[model samples]
Target chain A: MVIAAIAIARIHDLFAVVMLTGIFSLLGAAAYVVMDAVDVAFTEAAVGAGASTVLMLGTLALTTSKERPAPAKNVISALIVVVFTGVVLIYGTLDMPIYGDPMAPIHHHVADHYLGKSSAEVGLPNVVTSVLASYRSYDTLGETFVIFTAAAGVLAILGQSRLPRRHHDQEDSEKGMVSSPEKSKGAST
Target chain B: MEQFPGLIPYWVIMVLMMMGLYIVIAHGNLIKKIVGLNVFQVSVFLLYITMAKVEGGTAPILAEGIKLYSNPLPHVLILTAIVVGVATTALGLALVVRIHNAYGTIEDEEIDKLEDQT
Candidate 1:
């Protein structure tokens, strides 16, 4: 997974990068399966690896798939920032519970009830389903709303008419849409 | 090694997260940035699932005579997040297409230069 992410960062071809991300997500899902998170693994594989890749490819169809090399100056600054943040996060992880420690605090919370009493309260074999559909069903409802908003946002943004038929459709309109007042100052004025 | 048992997952996750961060920060392409965002989000989802693991646990689905199941809460949360993640990704790509339409270029430098002129 880490290797795929590194490849993604280093590769300049957007198409290849998108494919690697799908592979990386698949690797992540495999890891989840190993960790006993079958439900999450299923969802990650289906959505992260499957749907998102298709969406990215569709975007690539509309846009350039080759990344222009960045100017060389900001490289060092970005590396420095990333390294510093990573160090702080690793330090934070030092005190975390050992991996897969059954006695970890995370297991003792409402997770305990959803596991222990869920059979009686919700009467389902799958605690994840019961919790998702019943216990924290409102959160799921909110998530559905969020998805609805996203779909609406996509339609609102892309569905409008008078789409850019050509570069110079409306000279005044183009000038009006100019966001920067610096370079195009003479033209817009 | 004795002091830290199973801390390896964090190391892997952190490395992946940093790579994602670097891609988003260092690269200027909008589609590439979206891909970077997905990588970062996946690393986080991995973190949650890793935490949900038990020393010797099975999936959260109850089975006959099975007393050990990994925590189900993270699974439920991540299930919602994955779907939402895809929805928002599609929305983001739609926005990118719009940006491409408006500017005829998706590179930030070009977009900025175009914006600066007008």
Candidate 2:
């Protein structure tokens, strides 16, 4: 399902693709919830589906929707990636736990404590939250920094020193809207 | 046979998740992708709520006559998530309108050309 969605994202139009990205995040959130990690699901739904989509659309509005046609040579790289991923997954499955078996090592080990005694140990009812905010607090903090770094990177790459003037103003009024001071700086002074 | 109810909910959640993902990826319209994303997020909310439910659970709130409460934590978390999702969608749509104004077209490819020139 993830692979199909990824493919569609690239093949479809920009608007459709953005919507699909939201769907992808939502599905991922649901997958986390079904796996009994409610906190992760909540974060995924909010950050992935909500905030990220909004940010992407905002950027999209500033740019065009249509993607450049793929260079023929890029197809080779894509093929190599697909084959490598498939092989890795097939090999990984050899060591995976069978679907939802209660006796699997995953179900029997240290996780059992969080399920059985988290409320008493941490004085919190939500085991997932306890782990995220307490046990693995540093990891969560690291993730926040990672997100911050990404935002900084985007700003560095795409930040405009000055806003673009709207040519649409002239299209609407038909009188040819006079350029503002900023525009005069760039054009006929 | 009793376990059937437990299993069907999981399957339905998975199906919905997949469908939402497909729309997000396959569709080209900006608005359509947002809708697809909404559907995807809703499915996850449903899955979490389902897991929190016990066989014969009721509301988590305490009352003199009430007992057998199902988990309320998941529901509370989902409510907050929903609000965030809506806010994100609104922001995205607003950006699209702005983009349409700056560039003559909403198509993604045309935007690239304009970007290339500058």
lDDT (tens digit, per residue) of candidate 1 on A1-189: 878888888889889988998999999999989989888888888778977887777667766788898667666788999999999999889988989899999999899889988989999999999999999999999998887777767666666424654343454234323321221221111
Over A1-189, each residue of candidate 2 has an lDDT whose tens digit, in order, gives 355354444553665666666776777676655554455566667666666665555545454566544444544554455456445544444453333434445344555555456566777755556655666667556554544444443333233323454445534222112211212121110
**Residue A48, candidate 2: alpha-carbon lDDT:** 61
Winning model by TM-score: 1
Error of 1 at A153 (Å): 0.1
For candidate 2, give the lDDT. Answer: 0.52
**RMSD per model, one decimal:** 7.6, 10.4
Clashing pairs in 1: A180-B115, A183-B116, A183-B117, A184-B117, A184-B118
* lDDT of prediction 1: 0.81
Q: Is the docking of candidate 2 incorrect, acceptable, medium or high quality?
A: incorrect
* Candidate 2: Cα lDDT at A44: 67
Residue lDDT tens for model 2, B37-67 = 7666766777656655544434343344653
Chain B TM-scores of the candidates = 0.96, 0.84
After superposition, candidate 1 runs with Cα above 4 Å error:
A161-189
